[model samples]
Target chain A: MGQEHILKSHDNELARLTDEIVRMGEIAIEQLREAMVALQRRDATSAESVIARDVDIDELERVVSEDVVQLALHGPMARDLREILAALRIASAIERVGDYAANVAKRSVALGFTPPPPQARGLGPLAEIAIEMLEQVLQAYRDRDADVAAAVRARDAELDALYTALFRELLTYMAEDPRMISSSIHLLFVAKNIERIGDHATNIAENIWYVVHGEAPRQERTKLDRTSGG
Target chain B: MGQEHILKSHDNELARLTDEIVRMGEIAIEQLREAMVALQRRDATSAESVIARDVDIDELERVVSEDVVQLALHGPMARDLREILAALRIASAIERVGDYAANVAKRSVALGFTPPPPQARGLGPLAEIAIEMLEQVLQAYRDRDADVAAAVRARDAELDALYTALFRELLTYMAEDPRMISSSIHLLFVAKNIERIGDHATNIAENIWYVVHGEAPRQERTKLDRTSGG
Candidate 1:
């Protein structure tokens, strides 16, 4: 093959890989949306569907892993090497995001068995923030814009603050009314799942920054979740 | 350099990579142990130490990533390629294990503010199983023993069952005594951190199986943690 042909094919492969990752991120976001809808509507059937779809994200992750191996064997330059590494790490982060979404769905199913508590209202805002972070980070990754990625990283503290507040609220609610304890516990985990999705989004943001700059992000991540300390 | 000398140097690099991973695993285990002890003693000072030391595992992971990149650039054979992939994944998994240990420590610091609940005793047994699984999986990784790795994988179900039991028990405790609600919630997260550590160990075990067999383990993992479903 001609040298031009080789470079063209490599670029095409890189484009395809990027497309697959973007598609995976979209599906993960869909899963989170469906999960939140399931939670809000108390629809176990929708929750089950969301859980079933998690495998799609996992399968895409496997495909991305194989493509990374192929690209590595082609012996690209250092910049491309960073791209390959970032792709691997970012795919893994997205996979975990899907898992957390499924976890939220699973908790929604459990929550369905009981009367929805007033505090369940708190989850909607939390999921909204997390989903926004996921969307923004995926866009930053696609654009290779470190500035947008940094913005996503900064937004994680907002998610953490919401989570901590919800956590304390659930504890007080459960303590006031023992009947809400079981369902509140499930909500607690659901909130935690969403918070962790935000963390994964932050992870993706950092990977994007690394791919663009060939170094870790300059600023340290500031975590505001104080439930553990409270 | 002679061809034989080049091969010898490649082998040495591989050896160094393996040694670095093993050391990382050891530090992760130590962190878990120290976190557990810190929880049992309700010593925030010791817990603080465990949290501070998590950076060590993160640093080791960065080193492993660079080494993997260097090894990949050397044009490894197919088997060595699998080893490189597995090493990258194993390092990431161990880093997460370290993070969970730190999380456990953070929760312990919070728990120290309250009177020690009886539920705290349950965490010790859970941590023991998680630590054992981590140690066994690291050994399997070092020896490249798929059977041992599979055995470690099987043990995760035990950890899940223990975690589920603890989950139910803590919930019941909180419901019966509203005063224990805050402390029980912290214990819930602590148990979760240990359970997640077990899951990371399973991840490492699967990576070892992949390194040895060049494929994912054939048996589907059975998750026994039904707290989400319950």
Candidate 2:
């Protein structure tokens, strides 16, 4: 093949790789949303399904890695190479997010079998913040919008704050009724899994910024006292 | 330059990258050990230093990325390319391990200021398990030993089991005495952070297996009922 034809084919291949990653990102987001739904409704069947679907995300990550191998073999330019690396990073982050979702799903199954405490009320909103962060960060990847990614990164604190409130509330519940201890501990881990999902979304947003700018953003990541209250 | 000379230079660059990564891994392991010691002694000064040193790990990650870009720009063959990619993956995982250590350190500071609960006894062994995993995984990376890596991966379950035991112990403490509730929760998070550090070490072990085998390990990662009692 001529040089021009080969270059054009590389471009097409990169586009295909991008499409696959975006599809994988969508699946991960669906998994997060579905896990939250399962938790809210205490639906074990739905949570089980979400947990099962993580295999699909894991498979898609393998596919993306294979594509990365193919692209690197073709000797892409520096800009394209960095973009590929960023895609790989983002894919790994999204897969971890899927794992966190499955963790939440597993927690939902556990919660379904047991009686929940009254303080379980705040969990839905805590999960919503995480899901929304996942949504925004995935959108940031699709649009290559660093500003949107920054916005998603900043909003992680909201999840932290909500988690803090839930932490305090759950401790009080456990203290008030010793019988609530086991279930409250389970609920605490579920809250922690959701909070970690938010952290993964921020990781993805940082990858997005890296993809767009070819380096990490200059701002230091905001660190909050996540273990204390939120 | 002759083709042979260029190939040799590439090998040198790759070796340099690998050495840097090993150094970074050593620093991360030290951080984990220091954090655990600080927690055990309730030494706020030592914990503060661990948190402060995470910046060094972050800087090392940036250095690794720059080296990856430089190596990739040279258009090395597929084997060399995959090795470069694995180095990047391992570097990121170690940085995250450092972050987990810093998190443990932060928890140490919190636990130090607060009165301790008696159940805090279990945390020492839990952190020890996590530190052992980190040490073993880094050795796996240095040796490029897939067997060692797989062994490290399997040992994560031990940490999980310890964490589950700790979780139950702390819950019982909180249930019996309301006064122990606050510090118990902090201890709970410290245990969780140590468990997470073990997870990161497993991640690095997987990366090592990938780098050695040129694909993910064939074994499905061992899963245990981590949330329940041992």
Give the poorly placed runs of model 1, Cα more than 4 Å off.
Answer: A2-4, B2-4
Residue-wise lDDT of candidate 2 within B25-82, one digit each (tens)?
Answer: 8899899889888877888889989999999999888778767866876746657656
lDDT, candidate 1, B19-108, per-residue tens: 899899999999999998988889899999999999989988987987787787774665876887888899999999999999989988
How many residue pairs clash in model 1? 0
When superposed on Cα atoms, how far off is each prediction in RMSD? 1.3, 2.4
DockQ score for candidate 2 = 0.40
DockQ of each: 0.68, 0.40
| Model 2 TM-score relative to the real fold | 0.92
Best by TM-score: 1
Q: What tier of docking accuracy does candidate 1 attain?
A: medium
Residue A111 CA displacement from its true place in model 1, Å:
1.7
* Best model number under DockQ: 1
**Per-residue C-alpha lDDT of model 2 across residues A73-163, encoded as one tens digit per residue:** 6646657756766787888888888888888788878878676556778988988888888878877887889999999999988888888
